[model samples]
Target: MAEPLEIGSLQIRNVSKIFGTFKAVSDVSLNVQKGEFLTLLGPSGSGKTTLLMMLAGFLDVSEGDIALDGASIAGVPAEKRNFGMVFQGYALFPHMNVRDNIGYALSVRNRAVAEIEACVDEMLDLVQLQQFADRKPGQLSGGQQQRVALARALCFAPPVLLLDEPLGALDKKLRVEVQEQLKVIHRRIGTTFIYVTHDQEEALSMSDRIVIMRDGAIEQVGTPKELYERPKNKFTASFLGKSNFIHHNDKVYALRPEKIDLIVGVDHQDARMNGTVSSITYFGSMQRVIVDTKEGQKIEIDIDVWRNANEVKLGDAVDLLWADEAAVELQMG
Candidate 1:
């Protein structure tokens, strides 16, 4: 068995990246704990990729500092950082088989032949690719190719792994399967993983903490549950999940679809609103009902299909009820 890596914590102190006059990343400060799965999540042009590249030493920081385990690595080159990297393209050698590709890093370092072989074998088992050791890149599926790429990056037991949308090329079902596998690999290796992606579901499902970026700055950084349940601003709330924005008495609040209950032909006094069902969308597991209120606001409620005892249709009058605590107030950002 391969020994556990001495996982290092990372600290980004007011980091910024600028291209001439354009600020790609601006004054972003974040602290990542040892062995934590931290994901940088945002849409395109949100500076997530730029920040990741800076962390990987591919881009120079225009301002601020980056440190590993309390030591400044701002001057370190990408090759000297000893951080593993996995990209979306799965940059595997087309001519080499899985074993050779995974063992390339060790071979280049002039390690012993037996040591390289053992490390490659261990990586193959880590990624569950032991049976396809001799398969070329062309012979493997996209998911398998990605696994090989992961194994290659991790074979040398780097203290940190930087992944830039590594599973973006796979199909939806395959992507989900790989996410679970990646989580398992992280747990077993106990190495710090810094991931970047624009997929909300991927960040919510896999990350120990998510850093939501917007317009080249940090919007919010918190655990998935904390960000989902109590967002600090409108951008964080709407970006992380589906939310119904409610304006009441000069205050703005966000309520999740699942938190609202839909009732027909009955009215209650506690945080209730009456509306007509505008549309009903059937997703396999749940039904999304959009209600247009008399106050000219559209609210959405999610009802589990299996637990829905009452059948709701479009144009039906419905009442929406939710607890006061379920409505999270938003601040202007």
Candidate 2:
């Protein structure tokens, strides 16, 4: 009859939401394990937000039910669910100082003053915002304010944390920095995190598992390596990571740029894919070579250009070689 510090099995079964004729989410189901970082990944308008809203109890499911730890929470209210949620914008209280902002949720429940102070202090330290505890949201940097917002969400010790593009507003460098901090915090707390993001790099970096969604349905779900190496289809291959899909009659192989290597005269050795180098772009760290193969095939290969890759040039002949096992043959219409 006691709740585990973190009870994180969320089973969303056959959930759907419709805005008249169009279905925002259609009969989607997912199982999130205890203390796991799961990302709901998709482009905009792909029903990820709708699904999250349903889980948060902000939006009702037009059908089906949601259960946490084996109990159905179909009609439960948001406040009762006690979920820690952060949106794209750092939704901090503009009027409150950082300390008060971090303590807001606990205050709403009228937790004891001393307990609130201790929890708030712990959260501020968790997010490294202890020095800025007295500053208002407007005075702190975007990253700092988001950190405070994250602290606030966790201050309540919610069972699960929901992040909807939580790092979307920060600049690139700050985003990367905060992502590191977030991973550390997640490890320290060991809570279930359901993060939603369209950033492929972010998803690949932060999540313990990724759920790729398309057209109100799940395209694929797996760890980063699994998704990248064994994408079920061309769409998932291209969506989760950089992939050059070799269109085949019965199957499709999603090959990554790094998997390609140049063999000056080995085309005939392995299937013989003859191609003319259409363009070569020298990226300081790598070179991207686009080859137009015989039979109108467009193949892209990324070669490390530190010094060796400078050897490649446009209009040059190249024989590409990859192990027969490297190619991920796929079938797509």
Candidate with maximal lDDT: 1
Candidate 1 wrongly placed segments (more than 4 Å): none
Candidate 1 residue lDDT tens string, 66-107: 999989899999988988999879889999999999999889
lDDT score, candidate 1, position 98 = 97
**RMSD per prediction, one decimal?**
1.2, 2.1
Error of 1 at 198 (Å): 0.7
Supply candidate 1's per-residue lDDT for 32: 94
Worst 10 residues of 2 by lDDT: 263-272
Model 2: per-residue lDDT, tens digit, 1-333?
013464878998999998899999998988999889999999998899889999999998899889998899889999899889987798898999999998999899999999999999988878888889999999988898889889988988887899989999999999999999999988888889999999999999998999999889998899988988888887788888788877666667888988888644334566447677888877778888898887788888888776463676677777877787788877564
What TM-score would each prediction reach against the true structure? 0.97, 0.95
Candidate 1 has an lDDT of 0.92
Deviating ranges (above 4 Å) for candidate 2:
1-4, 265-268, 307-309
RMSD of 2: 2.1
